[model samples]
Target: MKAETVRTTLTIPRELLEATDKAVLEGKAKSRNDFVVQALRRELAAQKREEIDAALAEMASDPDYQAEVLKLEVEFATAQWEALQLGETPK
Candidate 1:
């Protein structure tokens, strides 16, 4: 499917615009819009990764979450032992 695009104007420093033009001429990007879009996508992905990392860090510090994980670990261990005794491997 083709995505819709909107025309927008931005104010950038002269040197930065010059650099972007140079990059476009070098075939690094199809155009200034493409370069900007790629940059935005990369930055958005980076921000999303940081958000996930922060959530994981917060979850690690959560005592209730830790207790639940430990409980599950013990339950799984017992189940695995029972399966082994029955000569069946638990998946």
Candidate 2:
């Protein structure tokens, strides 16, 4: 399936545009359009990850969530310790 695309004009620094063109000539990208699309996708993905990290940080600070996480960590450690005492080799 082909993705829907739009035609638009952008004003970028001359040096940056030249670098994109060079990528095409160097066979790093099939064309200027491909380079720009890949660049935009990377930037968008990074932004999304930043947003997710921020949200997770906020959640981590919540007292209820913190307590639950702490409880799980303690249980995990206890289980590992018990297993070791039983002469079980952990993978």
Candidate 3:
């Protein structure tokens, strides 16, 4: 499936543009547009991962959430033991 795209202009530095052209020539990417799109996608994914990590850290520090996690761990311990008894790896 094709994604919708917006056309725009960028003013990349000379050295970077040279490198980008080299990469495209070497088939690292199909074109400057594809290179830019891939780079932007990677950066956006990293940013989202950072946001998720921060949210998880906040949740880990919350007393109620921590207690609930511990409660679930305790609840699952018996299940893990049963799996071990059945010769499974207990995950």
Candidate 4:
């Protein structure tokens, strides 16, 4: 893969910027860009995982929904097994 470099601008409160600078000076962060990028990525990943887990919990809590999902999964696995036995592709 090729690497591309792009430049962007950010506007943050003075205090926040100062805090970030202080963190870097104190060895908390290697670089301001690295710190901000990592923090943003972690926050976004957590939000997405939380949403998925909540939805899964809701589905599992409903007996009917859980049954339907289990049925579908079983059907899917059975179809895949049959396809493999027959040397055919499973949809």
Error of 4 at 39 (Å): 0.9
State the lDDT of candidate 2 residue by residue for 23-65, as single tens digits: 9999999999999999999999999999999999999889999
**What tens-digit string does per-residue lDDT give for candidate 3 at 8-88?**
999989999999999999999999999999999999999999999999999989999999999999999999899778895
Q: How many residue pairs clash in each candidate?
A: 0, 0, 0, 0
Against the true structure, whose lDDT is highest? Answer: 3
Report the C-alpha lDDT of model 1 over 1-91, residue by residue, as the tens digit.
9789999999999999999999999999999999999988999999999999999999999999999999999879988888788886454
Sort by lDDT, top down from the best: 3, 1, 2, 4
**Tens digit of per-residue lDDT, candidate 4, span 33-81:** 8678778889999999999999989987999998998899987998888
- For each candidate, the alpha-carbon lDDT, in order, equals 0.94, 0.93, 0.94, 0.87
TM-score of each: 0.80, 0.74, 0.82, 0.62
Off by over 4 Å in 3: 88-91
Measured by TM-score, the strongest candidate is 3
Candidate 2 residue pairs that clash: none
Q: How does model 2 score by TM-score?
A: 0.74
- The alpha-carbon RMSD values of the candidates against the true structure, listed in the order shown, are 3.6, 3.2, 3.1, 6.8
Cα lDDT, model 2, residue 19: 95
Residue pairs with colliding backbones in model 4 are none
Question: Considering TM-score, where higher is better, how would the candidates rank from best to worst?
Answer: 3, 1, 2, 4
